[model samples]
Target: MTERIVVVAAALYDGDRLLAARRSAPPELAGRWELPGGKVERGETPEQALSRELLEELGVAAEVVERVPGEWPLKPPYVLQAWRARLLPDSPDPKPLQDHDELRWLTPDELWDVNWLDQDVEAVREAAFRGAGNCATSPNAPAPAPRQNPPNS
Candidate 1:
């Protein structure tokens, strides 16, 4: 049986920049850089889950703009749904609200610089090609390869 995994990320944008978090003490996987998000909760839609996660992780509200692309049925059994969001024009300043350490507004050129969680790497790769304008395109780009280097190689 395929283990179903779903993650919903808030594609937070401030003009040409997008917000990304460096996960510090993530409950499971710490020290990874991921877009602020979390697993979809039971009985909740992906959008609802995204909003909740944004609030929980960033101490800010997320008004979803559009569903970004680059989703796939991945190994480790995950089905991801990403969303675009407009941080309120006068959004209150963000505070460290969760396990993630720091936040940054990253441009497309800097997208690949962070070490990403296995599933989120594809989402990051897609961001550059899709532009920072929040295009609600489908999964037009190829998914990223699974981490297959022999353990401790």
Candidate 2:
């Protein structure tokens, strides 16, 4: 598969709960879970793409925290950069607006509970869990720690 530089956000609300999006029907990993963001269009700043994505996919605009810097450490082709964003209190009800089917709030303990995009698995391990479920209610969800590979001879 072609890996591309995607800009996703580990969006959170009330400071502790993360926002996860459920993919639409018949997705490669349909009914699976993922953070609410997407690929960074050319010429668009990672920050801009993230903000635009949230609106396009979830129907809400959020303030970019500009915390995490640089692209996430993934193999070439699938280069990605993301940030921690805070949803405004005035945020709209985030119903799935595009490829997504639903939205949810999950804690660290619950993050690894579902199948995530191959690239996003590591992010969940790194991002700290802030709060418990406040809105998570879907068909399902879990995290597997990264495995270390033995050095080749």
Candidate 3:
């Protein structure tokens, strides 16, 4: 059987707001919003891949917070997963330096405002639900568990 392509996405947050990005490439996906990330490289853990991807794509350092609860299928060979994350302390605020042409911080209520790529909708909803609770309201909320490689690596 063929191995499935695993992609990891960051539901990156600063308090209650999740960062959403607009795709700038591969013409078909351009202008559609997504949680910024890319395919996991062989031998790299999901956390490592996501951190590397965020640095390359957003020009900022990210600490993957926790994996969101479920996975979604992309086109045939690809499956997507999401994690909650935060910018590393003292990191520059993320800029859309690659892959993405625009960035916006959206509160849970605004989650549906952007035109997300269809495959990302369920993951986005899960992310919004996870972030909308106490995490959004309490500045003192405990940090999520430390990064671990995504399941089914």
Candidate 4:
């Protein structure tokens, strides 16, 4: 079986807002919004690849906060994964230096306003929850808790 191509997407957050970018190249995906990222190279870890991609595509230094907790399948031979990322404190504001033509920082209430690439919807939803402080639907709903590892033996 062919090895699946590994790709990474960054749900870049600035406090309660998440970043989204508009694709500018590749006729099929152009005009659709997606989290900024690119393929992981053979020798690089996903985090390294994501950092490199963010630098190359958005012109900023980023630090991966955490993986978004799921794997998403793309077209055959490709699988996409997501991570929470943030710009370094001293890094310049991100710009669309490649891949994308526009960038927007979206508040949680504005998450559904953009036309996202279909494959990205679920990942975006999860990222939105993280940004919105674990938005619980009902007052009685249990508040979301951060994952904790079992106590050391």
Candidate 5:
């Protein structure tokens, strides 16, 4: 069986607002919004990979707080894992330095305003449900866990 590749995404937030990035490349995905992040390199932990990706793609430093509750399938052999993140106090504001062409900060109510990439829609919903103040989690649901490498890695 082919080994699965993990792509990490950040549901980066400030107060109650989440950051959304608009893709600018790979014509097919251009103009679609997504939670900014990238693939995990073999030797790095997901948290490390996420931080590096944020710096590379958004030009800001971020702290990956916890893993979002669920995973989504990408193209064959690639699966998406999202984490809740926050900008570091000393970091500069995010800019679309790479894969993205635009950035927007959306409050919980504005979350659906952007045209999110198809594969990212559910993950974004799950992230907001768990992290955004306006979206409540059920008492029976487990809290998001801190970053950890997936089992059997």
Candidate 6:
């Protein structure tokens, strides 16, 4: 059996708003919006990979607060996992540095306004459900402490 690979996605929030990134490459996925993140490289924890990816793809420093409760299947041998993340105080604003062409911050009520990638739909829903419950209304809200143990892939 082929081993499964984990793709960590960030349900990155600023206040009650979640960050969505629009793919700019890979013809099939281009133009669809999804959470910004990437694959976990061998030897790296999902949290570490997520932080690295957010910095690379969105040009910001983010802290992974907690894991979303469930996982969803992606293409064969790959699965998607989500974590709630927030920007660090000293980090720069997010930019479409790579793999994306546009970025938007959507409040809970506007989550579905953009066309989401099919594979990401359920994960976003799960993240939104969990995130909305935990999110604070003010952008200045303190971020939850990062979890000590990341969920197993």
**Clashing pairs in model 3?**
none
Model 6 RMSD in Å is 10.2
Quick one: ranking by lDDT, best first?
5, 6, 3, 4, 1, 2
Better of 3 and 5 by TM-score: 5
**lDDT for each residue of candidate 5 in 1-153, tens digit (9 for 90 to 100):** 999999999999999899999888888887888999999999999999999999999989998899998889999899999999999999999999998888999887777667788888878878888876665434255433422321111
Candidate 2 ranges beyond 4 A from true positions:
1-4, 73-76, 129-153
Please give each candidate's TM-score: 0.75, 0.71, 0.85, 0.86, 0.87, 0.86
Winner by TM-score between candidate 6 and candidate 2: 6
Q: Count the backbone clashes (under 3 Å) in each candidate.
A: 0, 7, 0, 0, 0, 0
**Candidate 4, 1-153: lDDT as tens digits:** 999898899999888788999888887877778999999999999999999999999999998989987788889898889999999999899999997888999876666566778777777776666644653233233433322331111
lDDT of 2 by residue, 1-153 (tens): 764776666444544667777777554656666677777888898788888888888888788775443356555675656577777779886778888766777664555555666666555444443222333322123446433331121
Q: Please identify model 4 stretches exceeding 4 Å from their true place.
A: 132-153
> What is candidate 4's local distance difference test score?
0.81
In TM-score terms, which candidate is top?
A: 5
Q: Which wins on lDDT, candidate 1 or candidate 3?
A: 3
lDDT of 1 by residue, 66-98 (tens): 787768555577676667776776667666688
The 10-residue segment with the lowest total lDDT in model 4 = 144-153
lDDT of 6 at 74: 95
lDDT of every model, 2 decimals: 0.69, 0.63, 0.82, 0.81, 0.86, 0.84
Q: How many pairs in model 6 have backbone atoms within 3 A of each other, for residues 3 or more apart or on separate chains, i.e. clashes?
A: 0
| Rank by TM-score (best first) | 5, 6, 4, 3, 1, 2
